[model samples]
Target: MNEMLLAAFALFVAYLYLPTAWLSGLRPAKPMTRQANHLHCPENKFYIPEDAVLRRHFVSQLRWEIEAALHPRPTDSILQRHYDALVTIKLEQRLADMGCLKPC
Candidate 1:
């Protein structure tokens, strides 16, 4: 019953936000260019540049701040922590793949 109520509320919220978000001129990002490929790894298929990932995470944090201002949540938090954790794991894996016990 709680799950069903949550699902219905989530769907209603999405329906309300979809048109507002569309009207707010928020659109999907454009494709990255060939010259700007260092930010991503096509071979392994993930974001590669630590700086870019951090920058994106920072921007998202700011977005969450704005959202929190509009609608004050009891616990206002962004997913940057999770993003950083994943990035750390990915960086360690890449280092391991390159035969380094520790990053130089």
Candidate 2:
């Protein structure tokens, strides 16, 4: 019975993940040009350098900021608060242009 339960749990997990993986794979990937431009936030005020290494670092930092904002936790330590603040400010300005957020 324990073995059957384990098998069922594993299958359930796989069932949940497989469609997400397949759908992601099926989605058309953004072109490289578009990706290159992604480093430029909506405001166009803050941007990662065009260099690939810098762009990767910027993306990593952005992802950390986004995750932190979405999932605030008492135990979590912010690794890049200053940089994240700057990015957040720039993003807010951009969103304000679209009337999404009040201008600062």
Candidate 3:
């Protein structure tokens, strides 16, 4: 029957979309905390592409670019920049903890 088909389609759509919607807003809604400030990436005063972890050109800039893309927020540039910096810092810390980061 038409009703049965419509119900089945609705259930299929829910099954596919619900998980994505649930996971989309995983970031905290509140403003950044003091602890979060500590997690931000330090300013790069001196950078050398050859000494980078992957030896890629403009490695730090590339990282920031990727982080900015992956964790985009509907916020001002300053807040978004800070969020990306924190993401990079956390990524570096995780790599260091795992012993996967070679000294550069």
| Winner by TM-score | 3
Which structure is stronger by lDDT: 1 or 2?
A: 2
Cα distance off (Å), candidate 3, residue 47: 19
Clashing pairs in 2: none
Minimum summed lDDT over a 10-residue window in model 3 is located at 39-48
Assess each prediction's global lDDT (C-alpha) against the native: 0.54, 0.59, 0.59
lDDT of 2 at 79: 42
Q: Pick the winner on TM-score between candidates 2 and 3.
A: 3
Backbone clashes in model 1, listed as residue pairs: none
What TM-score goes with each of the models? Answer: 0.24, 0.27, 0.29
Task: Report the error of model 3 at residue 55, Å.
Answer: 2.7
Clashes of 2: 0
> How many steric clashes does model 1 contain?
0
RMSD of each: 16.2, 14.5, 15.6
lDDT of 3 at 57: 50
In terms of TM-score, how similar is model 1 to the real structure? 0.24
